[model samples]
Target: MLVGAASMIDSVRTWLRPDPIAERQVDPVGFAGTATVAATDYFAWDQEDKPSRTTALDRIAEPGADIDGWNGAGKQRVDGVAVLDVNRFARELAVVTVQVHVIPFTKPAAPSQPGGLKASWTALPARWLTAAIPVRSLPGGRFALSGRPALVGQGHSADLGNDAATEPPDADFSADTTVVVSKLLTAYGTGDLEFVRAAGAGFLGLDGAAELAELDEWRVAPKADNSGVRIGTATVRWRLPGDATLACTYRIAISDRDGIWLLSAITVDAGGPR
Candidate 1:
């Protein structure tokens, strides 16, 4: 009777347990269009008149697949698709999670106590590959790998960076540059010289308000260096009202001045301030 009861309890527990694999998604467009590698060849994927993200991913999974059909496909705007590579993608996330080095239940910055940043990779591959996807909608967004991560501290030849050097530092720095440039441009457009001078003290090179006011429009063209220190470009339509747009490249340098990442300097590259 004891053995039978135990058997019954085990059967009920098995039925009550949830499946291991889980559903996840990422925006492929976000991956390819900015700060990340192309989930798949965008040009080739857009071949379908009305391209489907899943179809594109399926084709990408094929080896040396002829993707010519996707060529010359018109502009594509993809969003809100799920990524289904459970084993690999989740493994990446797990790596990211372990990399945090903070105790899961404690404050992130608190020092490690005893056993810290524990991880087990034993079941990850099976979890990713064997996972079931009940809903088949909008898949293949995972391939949109984020920009080359500064994946330091992972047994690599460099203890130079901090442990909390999470995956998105490069992405964060790049985004910050865009914001600064935009702020400066807005001040220039609105003839707010006082604001410009104050904000651009460490950055912009302007002769005077009158010269800045000449900029009819300013825009941060998406072209930028993908490296850790992003050097970005902005198009300044000089002599505003009607002037050629000058491609201006600004070097964004981050410094640990006073132990904080103040935007140390935003100097123009050689022949940069046109």
Candidate 2:
């Protein structure tokens, strides 16, 4: 009886006629493809490319049947679609990180249904699996992961070079260093490129290479509060574009250059030094 009911529901869904109201609501620009889904690519939103919201759909449809003729063009029907706003998602993750404890984890062999003429996670009379992935970002520097079996099986390949120093700095620049680190991360969270540009300077960021670090939610604490000689430590996550993120805790040294505090030395967590 349950199987019969399920089959009946499937048949109903397949036989149902398309909704004209819903068809009118489809966005041509967004429908262009994944490249435009991020909205960061110029081709996705270029005025010349998107003459009307439905230009792509209209072009292939029969002249008189504007909205009703795409099927005649032999294109498969679409069920549902969505776009991810990664930046907004990142912000939301940030908030969640501050509000809760998130234990990092990874899950493999997760299940799914496949689809399309080509092979995919949902494509069959099959039991397929995949890994967990991030789907959205949260507030206070947090992000969430989602899994689709279709995206499984792909392996990552990249090399991380190393050259950072290994020793913690002398315990003399704690307060100033803490303030600098705080400001740097705050500016990074807000995407303030200018501030980030300045912070990447010799005395602000440990290395002059400040732009390399992205995913910036972090914690900083003073190792010693000797007033005259302050030492601090921080654990940070760096999300490099198209690369694996690296987690490390490092130390810093602040200097007084004519009254203004500036960072002068940095020691990345090199396994040898905690």
Which model scores highest in TM-score?
2
Give the lDDT of residue 96 in candidate 1.
Answer: 17
Name the lDDT value of residue 253 in candidate 1: 40
Over 1-274, each residue of candidate 2 has an lDDT whose tens digit, in order, gives 9999999998787569645444334222222232122111111121122343245533322223212101111111112222322111222111000001111212213423354243221111212111111222212222222111011111211111111223344334433355566654434333342433323333222222122243233233333454332224444544322222333343434434445544333333212111
> Against the correct fold, how does model 1 do in TM-score?
0.22
Model 2 stretches with alpha carbons more than 4 Å out:
1-177, 184-231, 242-244, 272-274
Where is model 2 poorest over a 10-residue stretch in terms of lDDT? 93-102
Worst 10 residues of 1 by lDDT: 123-132
Which whole-number lDDT from 0 to 100 does residue 170 have in model 2? Answer: 38
- After aligning candidate 1 to the native by TM-score, how far in Å is the CA of 245 from where it should be? 18
CA shift at 60, candidate 2, in angstroms? 56
